[model samples]
Target: MVTYLLDIMEYADSDQVIEVLGGAVSTRVIRHPNRSFAFEVTLDLEKGSEHFSTKPPLHFHANQDEFIQATEGKIGLELEGTEYILLPGQDEYCIESWANHRSYPLELERQEGRTVVKFLLSGAKSPEVYELNTLFFENWYKYQEHVVRKGGKIDLIQALSTFDAGGTYVSFPRWVPFGRQVSQLIGIVVGRWLGGLLGYQPFYREWSTDWQLACDKMESSIFQRRWAVRSKPD
Candidate 1:
């Protein structure tokens, strides 16, 4: 018997990534619940050519699975008590909640010339997911501030709207790799026109009561709004 899996990224409407705080740590998510058990597949693409580029630090998904595949360039994977350097066409698979690990570029050559794609398979949504999002956004602001303090130009409008989509609610945005500039803009315009025809099936909603309260508080906060407003003239 044979089984087939789809490279769903090809059919996606958005790039499924966040570029502001986390740089190019972008992803596209697909959720499958009608199957035996709920699972999530996220394709993370990272470019090594940019300044201040780095992958997430060492950590593990509490109740999630992960599979790392090197499609265009080489990547390093540490799993099951060992580290492996994966080249193009190679993949490293790991069971969810079984190991603690992370990946990083091994050299400047690979850092500047390689593109690595990591696939994260989760059995179900995990708390670390939200934690990671918060960290990325917070740290990204720090990074932006650092850059500005150092006399680098920063986009305030773009920075304040980091993961926002101009509404009371927000979800993952359609993402496209930086290399695919035209395609990215076109995808966003097309998706807006077609109502997310190629959007992901499984979405992690951030409308929890706490999320709502946080959003409300943020909206009402004078300081936060001032910062966001100040960020807009960039």
Candidate 2:
């Protein structure tokens, strides 16, 4: 594997775009030199054709807290045991630390055009949250192509294991008996040993050429988009 020296100062652009769940996601650092304080991420999705209604797995951030604002369209969020639908221009929905939450688009069939929503994340231990996000997306992006072509599935155990290393725990769905404990144990073992053997690095390595390539791709796309918007007729 080739390695490249990456500048820490330029890790992510304030307007960098990255691919996620077959959608375009743009992330910006809200706080200054210290990103641990807070950061913002926005997802843009097309109506009808894009499947944005599927919710993420039920999970909790042990340290980080998140607030979501919908700029356009509506978003559904499950915080703790209650559900909420945030409309455009409404107040931000806050999810405190340790609260189990899941987010998804609301009423996709009724929505038209495009949808955009932003998330502001912050907490005392927010750095770990950011690291976990980076690791999860890196692994997902790396294997997305292969998984699609082979009609294969993502290894949930492996993903849980990798996230465990960054202090994010994946809770088992209620259907499985004693799944929480069992999955935790398996995650710890695989994350430490098997994941290492397979060369899964949970943390960002600036020296990895893969990291450099991913950053370059995102930045280039953002630059091109900005140039196009500027050159368009008013």
Query: Largest TM-score belongs to which candidate?
Result: 2
Off by over 4 Å in 1: 1-10, 21-23, 30-56, 110-234
TM-score of every prediction relative to native: 0.40, 0.60
RMSD of each: 15.5, 12.5
* Error at 15, model 2, angstroms: 3.7
1-234 in candidate 1: lDDT tens per residue? 211123432335542333332343443333333211221222224332443354543344333454454444446676544787755454335445435466554544554553444433323334332212332333344555457458776543332223222110121123523322343233234422222233311111222112432343334433232222212221
Regions more than 4 Å wrong, model 2: 1-14, 21-23, 28-40, 47-53, 110-146, 173-186, 197-199, 203-234
lDDT of each: 0.36, 0.50
In candidate 1, position 191 carries an lDDT of 24
- Candidate 2 achieves a global lDDT of 0.50
| Predicted model with the maximum lDDT | 2
